[model samples]
Target: MGATPVQAAEDGRVNRDKLRELIGRMTLEEKVGQLFVMRVYGHSATAPDQVDIDHNLEEIGVRSAAELIAKYHVGGIIYFAWAHNTRDPHQIADLSNGIQKSGLQQTTPVPLLISTDQEHGIVCRVGKPATLMPGAMALGAGGSTSDARRAAKIAGAELAAVGIRQNYAPVADVNVNPANPVIGVRSFGADPQAVAELVAAQVKGYQSGGVAATSKHFPGHGDTATDSHTGIPYIHHTREQWQELDAPPFEAAIAAGIDSIMTAHIVVPALDAAEDPATLSPPILTGILREQLGYDGVVVTDSLGMQGVRTKYGDDRVPVLALKAGVDQLLNPPDLAVAWNAVLAAVRGGELTEARLDESILRILELKARRGLFKQPYVTHKGVDRVVGTRSHLASADRIAEATTTLLVNEGGALPLSRRRQPNLLVVGADPASPSGSTGPPTTVLAKALTELGFTATALSTGTAPTAAKIDEAVAAASGKDAVIVGTYNVAAGSAQSTLVSRLAATGVPVVTVAIRNPYDVAQLSGQKATLAAYSWTDVELRAAARVIAGKAEPEGRLPVPVQRADDPTRTLYPIGYGLSY
Candidate 1:
């Protein structure tokens, strides 16, 4: 007896037809299951935190992966391998397979969607480790959309090889505010048009390479000074502000056929005065995202447990409210049962309609089917060792690191420090921590490269009080030497290096300040002979900076942001598009 087409369809992975058929057959409960995306940790119990009596306290750890899927029939899973948990990429792969297997055990043959936040090649879950590409700002510094696309391709290929079908990345927020914490490194740059183009390329790169890309923090998180994860942050800008800066990249991404849009928990008072928070606000998600911007793809939320929502809505009810607000999937809710029950309660109480649940479920199923989850024989037993941190990928990462380094300032031929009988070099900056946490390279990777070029180098560690006297001593040490390089690490969050930069630049020995964080610091060091902004402390930037200083490489890096005059507090520390070549 030959098999019927329906039977063959049933055996194969989910496609559009299969998804439609499954949706038609699903009960209300099944439909609701597809709307919930939960965080999953593998079999290990003692993870994320010291085996707290309550395991799911931290964002990284969760209740057993099996329990969540088996009980709730979750639509998707977001993977994050925090430090405490088993960091093995293969272990994560095994866990991913385990999730699918658990999903298949359900009465309905729905495949679970697996995702991760592999925004940069450094942030990936699978494949041989590649170089941590410079954050968006570095690509902006490189002054090319192609660099952004190349970065996305590397990140996508690495993630997809490990079965991460969805990547919640390419943060589309503009980095306009220097005081803005948590977003400086993540955003591409401050320029709206440049950010839009680069983000669109990133989306294209991820999707084309098989990993679904998500343009994040819609409306925008750019202008705000607060961190959404910490509290209820609001973008005080008006509708005009949003239309010009915050809304551009999102529009570009949607136009580029982005697979998903993740809503930030930010509130834009200009858009919706009442119920301003975007995550649970209907006006923002439905009215603006769906109706105005015309984004028809899946809408996912930032972690529900973040204080932006949780502190405001409490842990129990936020998930259900998010669904009512039109978010198709929730990211990392507090409790799966609590969230699921809340959804059920909402459905029973008429707060959430079955029709609404079906809409989200159908979309999820469509996405899964689109991913070939229903038709294919999913083999989760991928030996992760072969794919994770492969040599070829690592080499590419090195190249990206090298190419993305931008030289912000060089004056009076002060750079390209002498290689033979080299001038005395003083290095100060990032902890020389290797991947193994061993003191790898001091003074950023670029400083290490300078050492290799034969510069006699001295590293002055930036202590709590980075004083002018210590800098003067270093300058005195190199009294007859050709140059003094002060590598400052004050850009990224958790920095205490700004004092050192100011102190060192004060000593007049042809001082050059290398800023690997914000380019604004260039204005702070106008008294110095030269200032450089590499935007990040990644190894690649380190090497590029070394080459540029040693005169081995030309200073081709243009300022991605404005360079403020060092003395101008009223003016931007650095105006956008300010860079120097000597």
Candidate 2:
């Protein structure tokens, strides 16, 4: 039987009766606004008609964020660094408070759900002085649910302190393809059960830290070769394989009572023969996620502007179809007027009934109440920095990063080098700058770390493809050096880093190549003196790698995913749990 009003209120902590009456009183335009989670341009809630980096008056057709809320009655706002919404902790809190103030001042006064993609490791939108934990795959390598939970709790707590209530995090993709460009290091691991356990733990951890947790890219975006942001990738998993590989993490999420699930924009031809993205397919989102998975919580579509959703449907039809497919929140449509009016028109044209929207609106309102936003949504600006990047939080992040140091190959006690023996070290190789615009490459960070540890380390920033001159320069630099370390990022068997490593190994200076991004490069650099997988090039990870080199810390991480054979992608060079200890 369905829950009674009192039972429902107890279960979801929402005043269902009040929300229902409010919905009955809502105008058609206001009801339509409750369905969208839009993006606005600025750092301030209300601003003058001026132009700046983030405040483009021409683009938004409004002065500030408050104007967007008043003009369109958007239910939520998502922040991006490019939008200049997160300049710092205090600013973010002020902006969030301002947005909530305007949202509550409306005629129908609904509090906005403020959100960001604070996925922590490579995908983090909120940068330092916020504590940045080692991301998902690093936790997979650490092989501890407690560690994963603790890291997530810290990250979620910092976001909450700043009034960001929703974080699109704990990516449950279960990456199995070594060649998958987008989700390689973002996923937990290739093992479905392992990923499931970590995903469930992270869900509880994030919620306990005071925000809603979203397990995203539903129905398994793990094996796709194409990124959904640029092109729609098809997953050819048979029904049986999908059951084995793709279904477990989401099932675990639902079992954990996750607050929301975001739909992937890919198509699984086996699940539904139609070529429509899962964002618009009834069979996939409703038949599978709603009925089979038994998830009645808020269902959000991935960004509508992504190429994955734009392939089949026009801009007008995308939002309406997604709503028809049972998605509660339409996220980030490029054209606000077109998508918003299309959804409004669909309800008026009788293609969509108001009852369908009420189902979603009630769930959204219930979520806000469950999060305790209705009572106290504002955050003091001064309190933001006290909780964001505290010493304990930074220490916890360091512990997680140090634990993810996986030593792939250590020949004859090659690692744990003595500072006295390896005093003069040459650090060179591809140090790709962070896509998120972090400080210099891993090479520079490692050199700086070693110097801090009382080692005279010389850094040579060789591009990934070392030119003839750079190669010769690195080789000359390696001559007579006590030891040499090279950082490689996602190098294939015959790739440029592979060629560079072969040349450096000939120097007989104990060359160690650390896999900074993709650990699959292990198969390519197997002949080095030693290889370590730090999983990411973030400063914390590199500093941990440096400590291990200086005999200060132990390498505790193992390969989360199997290392694919360089020549043949079907086989593995090393198993998932393979890592050497010094």
Candidate 3:
């Protein structure tokens, strides 16, 4: 009913005159609340008796999403399935509409920025009914910016259709570390230039889709080994290397007019010796991102609940310090009231001026308006089915997934398992853990795809660390099958996962290994008859992998990152851009 965010002020940009006047009318508490993007636990926005509403009550002392908004004048709400905030497409749309309804009833009536970590592949928060895209590394493996743009566009449109106007996606990290615990396959690739190209494309794609895109973990979360959710990792890259390795993607995203840039919680001594992590570092956030890269877009912090960002700072102190460091948003602090009150107190105490808070509020208000939230914030529930998970999006996802199904090793031409002969296949491996905690989607998807293609495919989920009995069962299953397909997840050379692949390879059956989660798993799985990377263990990715094995889809993807030898990091086993096709 209204213009997309990208076109709201197509030529003139946001109405600063109106936004500033509205800011002048707001109380300091309201302005401070606008900077926070809090998380509430519930499937229904206004339902107090809904599932997981206790978490909302305990966290924010609010029983409903509507209460969280009306009580705090909250500016944004991020949904997570784990928090019981999302389910099917219609439920998510209804929840979003209810949240917007509460926000629109505010004194000044600003639209809430409803968002989620819809990073598709492995990090997907919403599933099934929402169309999933082949994630960043998959797009990188395919090495097509055009496809990347289309995938994000489709995903963005789907999210927007469900009233989710903001997506925390298009991970710009150039994952260089094989052992990176957090941002491995989530990144575009190991190369800065390639990652930059895809990031720019996705930014434009999401913008074109009516949802505001947030390019994230700014200054790069690619090379670090630590998971910021657990602990703070320090990057050792020099200032020049940061510019070369980490800066290009963000630079490109900014150039593409990305609506937001989320900050990383990691410490980079190169960027600022003064600031422990990039999230609260003025030198990094203000000096580098804002001044150096010239990004005028919203600077949102990585979750304040993360151990990395909260380690050196207090719960209340994190928000204040982050604001002082030029962050426009403080995302999901563990306690909402503490963060809000601390910020409110800082302004009242003259530690943080109301004028300072206005800077962030104005930008946030502009974002809300640009997204056409001012013109139309609600969506009809009927429209959710029409756009959320359409057939065309699924086809595009499959196409992108097929493009990323890379053949890393095909010794003796073990792949293209004979469909005419009707090979009985055994799909057995650990169903990798997703960020959302669900496992076995990829393993099951692979089996289903193989079976649909006329193969007798049986799937067995060997738990992450397979027990002796589980491995024996898998080995026994492989012994009877015509061929064995093992899905290895982030395997180290002599690790139990590598041992599983080795045991499967010795089954006297033609063994095909799929690097289901990380592409680096292939380096340790050298003994397998064939090896390929699906990049991520999502439905589409593994489905594409199955099609490739069954000769239905060609392995068109190349290695996005180099796989170094297990024993020596110096030796390259498979260089970047290395992928075999028969």
Each model's lDDT: 0.67, 0.85, 0.86
Could you tell me how far off, in angstroms, the CA of residue 531 lies in candidate 2 after the best superposition?
A: 0.6
TM-score of each: 0.86, 0.95, 0.96
lDDT of 3 by residue, 1-582 (tens): 323222233343677887887788777778988999988888888784544677777778988989998899989999888887777788888888888888767776677999889887788888876788888889999999999999989988888888888889889988988889999988989999999999999999998988889998888998888999999988999999988898999999999999999999999998898757899999999999988888887889999999999889899899999999999988999998899999999999988999998999888888887887877788877788788778988888888888999998888888888887788999888776653423345667789889999999999998668878888889988877889888888887677877887787777878898888888887776568899899878778888998999999899999989989877889999999999998
Best by TM-score: 3
| Alpha-carbon shift of residue 213 in model 1 (angstroms) | 0.3
Ranking by TM-score: 3, 2, 1
Q: How many pairs of residues in model 2 come into backbone collision?
A: 0
Comparison by TM-score, 1 against 3, better one: 3
**Of the candidates numbered 2 and 3, which has the greater lDDT value?**
3
Task: Go through the candidates in order and give the C-alpha RMSD of each one to the true structure.
Answer: 4.4, 3.6, 2.4
Off by over 4 Å in 3: 1-13, 48-50, 434-440
lDDT of 2: 0.85
